[model samples]
Target: MHSDRRVVLEVKDVSKLYRLGNIGTGTLSHDLNRWWHKVRGKADPYAKVGTINDRTEIGDSRYVWALQDINFKVYEGDVLGVVGRNGAGKSTLLKVLSRITSPTTGTLGYNGRLAALLEVGTGFHPELTGRENIYLNGAIMGMSRKAVSARLDEIVDFSGCAKYIDTPVKRYSSGMIVRLGFSVAAHLDTDILVVDEVLAVGDADFQSKCIGKMNDVSKSGKTVLFVSHNLAMIRQLCNRCIYLENGRLHSEGDTDLILGHYLTKNSDTARTFEHGPIRKVEVIPETESIRLKCHYKVDRIVHIPNLGFVVNNQFGSSVFGNNTLNSGMSANREFPAEGVIEVEIKSPKLVVGKYTVSIWFGDGQEDFFHEPDCVEFELIQKSTSQFAGSAKVGSVLTDCEFKISAL
Candidate 1:
């Protein structure tokens, strides 16, 4: 589909398999058989023996395929987002591209140098200082000492660990380690960058900074393969996305459409509790306020201490939250066997973006029903404000009159 653009990476029929149990007894035989087939230019014999990776069920075979018949292409300067549920073959695909592991079948063709930060402290030595490891990683990437020295200061400053540059990596916290690792990988002049969910180890501010750096990298005409559970980041940082499910390519297309599909597929609406006080939960978005409705039925008197919703933006940041206790509602009362309770959040001014709502019902310490990502909706600007082009961008909007005073 990207014929007009030059391809940077190509993956064809890629698959990875792992033995389920112990690896001692029949491993040698399988390895010898694989080598025999390779010498004869035949397909891998074990490729036909593995089952699809489904964590909820046990398969008949002893081997499982982490990836199967996976295929896609990454054009030069493309920021590709890889998304799926846990154990969905995302990391395995990246490892194959990074050459940390070879596919059991098929092949990968990539041009230019590639760098991967698949985990925190992936290529670091615990005994080495941060400064030393920077060069060490550069050396491992086939760069000379003089070449690494040219970008050493930029890496240290971007990592925000300049003061700890001389300290051994063992002393750094997990966040610091990730910061340094990402800084090195991003600044090493690699044509292709592979990043996993390891960015989650850093704090919120650091994560934002790293996203900004990735944006710069994409603008500089390099290729990026980013994998994360944070769909909002994927939407903002990537122009194209790949949705992998059950070790296969489910869909691949534009960022917004793919994310919509992913969110719809992973919604937790089917959750239920046995004989619980609550019966239903719903969120209705209105122009002025969001209407939350909770229907319930009870045989005996029941008291609920807390009940309300929490709103979060795309990056999973909590925008606002409220509960019955904090709103001065009673917890020592009973409700009708069949009745509806409604709460209105009035004048919730928010920016133009998608948001998710989580509803909870129970006491402060204990929960009767807590549903996350129950509803997702977008807020759009009805009219462009005179100040819309201003640099003060934020998720929340407020109505205030502007005044100017003479000096």
Candidate 2:
């Protein structure tokens, strides 16, 4: 992939401005001004002024720049990972690249056909059958009927939805629709693929399959722009990464370095309430399961506060967790001003990786204290598997034994 690489896509100063307000034709004066600017070959007055896209704050201008000064060059056979917090304009960037929407400013130059899976069912008509949608997508991509017919069997087999191929896509589940949609995008004759959080909707096996497919595509001298919150998948599939923050390109370059910066930025920021103050949290590994102990100070005497913990993998996806009430256990004990609570997870079946723990102190209905990143630990197996560290499919590794018998 590294040999004889050339730039396949170039995005220069791309910015998308969205006006916030009622959706309708603007006042007559504004429309005339826009037309006048177009006649004079001048920039639209509205494009010059816009606030940063911060949903939490109110700006003087009704317009917001969803993307600002975003520039990147993607080379042939490069798997570029785009990552950021929610509302970071990752999807907007992809939409612009896919030509589903045009940027308010700047230009994009690229070579070859581009295919995107922006959402679960972006191109499909709900009333159409799965089989019909495949053909429709091919037509939309400007492919001949013969071309799509040749690949129909491969698409159907990859989707694992042959049984429902003739059924209306509206009846299919989200996961099934994603499988069918991804299979089409992957098998199409496109030089570049833009995918947005496709693994977020798929099952563990399906996610593994999709990652493998993307890997194969990269190997075939194609470009991929992947946007995902799943850092593990990004690290696995992407050779380059771009981090966007507040609708702007914050950092771009190596994958591991950028991911490290992202994790550090989101490490510690949890809301606290009047219920209690958690002093410290620790996760200790044991032979069977891990032990999570919380040392806290209770300000006032409160009835059994529900104590729970959530474990998130390095990709920032919640893997496994349990609350006392949900687990059929009640901690209705009176709390002193200061105390320690220890919860032991039985058979913690997590794959070997670095994981962050988020602890919660709630009163059944409301959260008293929430710590997003209370502790971090690595899960290591005492013994390696027979395959010697083959990529684990998902975050959890269930306990089971395999046996073979003659039929």
Winning model by TM-score: 1
Candidate 1 per-residue lDDT over residues 361-387, each given as its tens digit:
775678877777767775543443413
The 10-residue segment of model 2 with minimum total lDDT is 381-390
Q: What is candidate 1's TM-score against the reference?
A: 0.73
| Model 1, C-alpha of 223: deviation from truth (Å) | 1.2
Question: What is the Cα-based lDDT of residue 76 in candidate 1?
Answer: 88
TM-score of 2: 0.71
Candidate 2, residues 181-299, lDDT tens digits: the string is 99999998889999998668888778878888999999999989999876767777788999988889999888888877776665442233344567777777566888888887877
lDDT of each: 0.83, 0.83
Error of 1 at 11 (Å): 1.0
- C-alpha root-mean-square deviation, each candidate: 7.0, 7.8
For model 1, which pairs clash? none
State model 1's lDDT. 0.83
